[model samples]
Target: MQVHIRYFSVYGSTQTYAEHLAGLLNTSAHPLEVPLPDDATPVIALSPVHGPVVQAATYARKIQGRPVAVAAVGMTLLDVAREKDSLRKLVPEHVARFYLPGKLEFSTMSTAHRATLASISTMLRAKPVKSANDKAMIAAMGTDTDRMDFAELQPIVQWVQSLR
Candidate 1:
């Protein structure tokens, strides 16, 4: 089946997941900015959480009425699974939502993001809180290695499989 994997990956975790998934399904992933006019395939909009929201609502708005699924990549996936409000804010009206954790390397962060992180620290009035040790488990490597294990990605994989 033709599938459109449109993603907005800031730190690349979701992009890695999209690439891995595309390889598994033998499809190519596309950027959200490019229009997919002739391809009638359904879409999967993958994004990561930033500050207070998933980093690309404008991109999300672009796919509103299309046949789309959304997966929110974040650090709190396991901890916030039952938080309907957070999940809702991530992927509203999506056919399905997948919670995937994200990783960050301050060195790799864009100047803007680094600045934003610095700003957050100032606001919180604390030494920069690193990605907490408790949340850095292998499973949480979904955020670290910029790769998510296929087994862990199965929920979205199964959903895509079911679509065909």
Candidate 2:
């Protein structure tokens, strides 16, 4: 089966994953801004997760009832339970979900995004006790931190192949 790959990326990590997956599947990846090619093509949407938000949720909702899968890329690590809970809140339960690690490139971020991170960093610093994740976030504030791996696309690739 032919599949359509779309990505909504902020700092390019999600796009990188989408393109790599597309290459493996022998398809091309398009930005989410492009309209879907057809009704029957299964869609794999790779979107960045910023804190509580999954950037492509609105697009997913817009294309409801289609064969759609969402790959959420983020820096924060989560247990399986938390991942499920977060996905429930961010997208429709019917949508298949996957999580992938993402990179944070502070240098490439817009001024507004950087300022917002600075604010978040300040709030995190104010906390009396910090989790390991929080400490890592604090340390990565003004630098580029990458957690992406092309091997992580295997599950998505397997799922897409199953559709055939």
Candidate 3:
């Protein structure tokens, strides 16, 4: 079985993972904007997570009824149950899900995104009791923190290989 890799990336982290995963699978990665060659091919759609939203939800919906896996890239630390629960609301329950840590590059973000993050940071800072994750997010607001590790993609690679 041949698997196709498609990615929707705003800040490039998803694309990075997509390409690496493609390499591991001996396939090339294509942007989600490019239509898949066929409906029968299994797809691994990767997208960046913006809070509760998964950017590739629309694409995943369009590719329904085939074998599909969604890899959500975000800056937050892993909480499998939380992440999976968040993803279930956006992606169909039948779609397989995975989470990978992504980089936070303020410089690469658009003005609107930057402003939104600033607003969230302000809100989190105002909380009287903040969790460690909240504090980490606040600290990471303006800095470029690279949390992308190629080794983190091993699980994805294994999943793709299983298709064979």
Top of the candidates by lDDT:
3
Score residue 20 of candidate 1 by CA lDDT: 81
lDDT of 3 by residue, 1-164 (tens): 57888898887788989998988888999999888885678898999888667867668877855788888888777664344456777777888778888898988889999999999999999999997778888999999988888887888777766767
What overall lDDT, based on C-alpha atoms, would model 1 receive against the true structure?
0.64
Q: Could you tell which candidate, 2 or 3, scores higher by lDDT?
A: 3
Order of quality (TM-score): 3, 2, 1
Model 1 deviation from native, Cα RMSD in Å: 4.9
Better of 1 and 3 by lDDT: 3
Encode model 1's per-residue lDDT on 2-99: one tens digit a residue. 67777787767788888887887788887677676665577777787775676444465556545666777765545454364464664556556667
In candidate 2, how many Å is residue 49 off?
1.8
| Runs with alpha carbons beyond 4 Å of true place in candidate 2 | 78-85
TM-score each candidate: 0.70, 0.89, 0.90
Q: Which stretches of candidate 3 lie over 4 Å from their true place?
A: 80-84
How well does candidate 3 score on lDDT at residue 33? 89
**Best by the TM-score measure:** 3
